[model samples]
Target: MTGEDIYFAGVGDVHGEMYEMLGLLKKWESRLSFVLQVGDFEPHRHEADLQTMDAPGKYRKLGSFAHFYNGSAVFPYPVWFIGGNHEPYGFLDRIANNTEIATNCYYLGRVGTVELAGLKIVGLSGIYKEHLFEKRPPIEEIDRHSNADYIGFTENEVLQGLEFQRADILLLHEWPRGLMTPDNRLDVIDPEMVGNEYARMLVDSLKPRLVLCGHMHRYFCHQIVWPDDTITRVCCLAHTRSGSNAVEIFRLSGNRSIESLRSLDER
Candidate 1:
């Protein structure tokens, strides 16, 4: 990599294991420009905050977010993330979109766009649910609703995401449809139940060079070639429990095109 080359890390679903996630990325922290995490990060500040997350009681440990929140542990690099099905909605709902939730940490909100290292990055948080697709109650009413109420991406959010003309990288919590073919089918995930149509539409419309996602807790890579020969690379990552498979690194040139990409587990 040259001085003009930008290196960054993309992390999979954290599921509240902040300490483990940080440890996994420690080796590359000094070289990375930033870290982008796909959702289910679960940055809860306290027990009350954990209650607002949509997860089973057994899976709801507070993890390590509170240490970061209380200034005990600082993030090694700038971390940007979208929300997943599992998140602290009670606390995040109180803040505005793209707001910094902690020092050097930012939440990309329901639909967000940001420019980084000369690349246009867009993110759409949460999974798609047909019943909740068109529903978005006022933010003020978020507290009154159950934790499950805020887990899905609304139709309005998807429409808002479509406004971006193009993107160098698109962040999503779930995989897009059409990624699974007979050659790449995994016994762990059903071919028909793996991805969502809205996400596929976003990829086809925005035509981003790269798409990063988590939620399914499995690592897979696929490429979509448009009629014009433009290619979009999609990488689905596993959860933190899978160790190195949950993280991937990318090196981009000054021109904002990917020069090299590899998963931590490659070695």
Candidate 2:
């Protein structure tokens, strides 16, 4: 069976840019079924700032977004958001949405699964801060450390708490470069071994068919070979520096591709 065509207007780290993006999305609702974003809604909260602050109430704009996002006053599609390290809460898995936007925004926190048109979608969000960056020093020092603990904690939460041991579609925020990819090659990486270790564990253990992530936003969309001849399509979308992006689309008729899908983004 051919894969269905599902439109996903996904973007992240827009922070103050949500209003502009939201307007554009309204015009393109006819062609999309859902949307996805990887985190960093607050452009101000860099990795260094997250560890130092105890209560990031300053970034309450997200709460406002949640209020509107969960409401039907304005929106045309469902939004699937994974917690970025910038997300100030713990286990962001709760989801509330309205039908006017046809939007069902769900944040899986660490790990989750979604079924659309007979396809399975799984995800894990938020940073593994407890293990990676519990203590905050200076801004300079925070950068020196790695977000592996944060990544690992998220993974642990998904695997241990959610019971998503075997996912057909896995979503993670980090990419580990040290483990053997689904293609059986050593996935070379930099920074903390734990970050690589954590992601690699999913790649090695879960062996999903597709994995979408958005942490090292350098524009990544490729395939990895895992054990048992399984291939994992890992995608890292580049957030719009100006506007929104056409990141997701679904067609039950199997007419899915970046080329044929409608584009309403005005970025």
**What are the C-alpha RMSDs, in order, of all predicted structures?**
1.8, 8.1
Query: Model 2 — which ten-residue stretch has the worst lDDT?
Result: 93-102
Question: Candidate 2, after superposition: displacement of residue 92 in Å?
Answer: 4.1
Q: List candidate 1 segments past 4 Å from native.
A: 263-267
Summarize candidate 1's per-residue lDDT along 102-128 as a digit string, tens digits. Answer: 898999888898887888889999998
In candidate 2, position 79 carries an lDDT of 65
Summing lDDT over every window of 10 consecutive residues in candidate 1, give the lowest-scoring window.
Answer: 258-267
- Candidate 1, residue 256: CA error in Å? 2.6
The TM-score between candidate 1 and the true structure equals 0.95
- Best candidate according to TM-score: 1
Clashing pairs in 1: none
Candidate 1 to native Cα RMSD, angstroms: 1.8
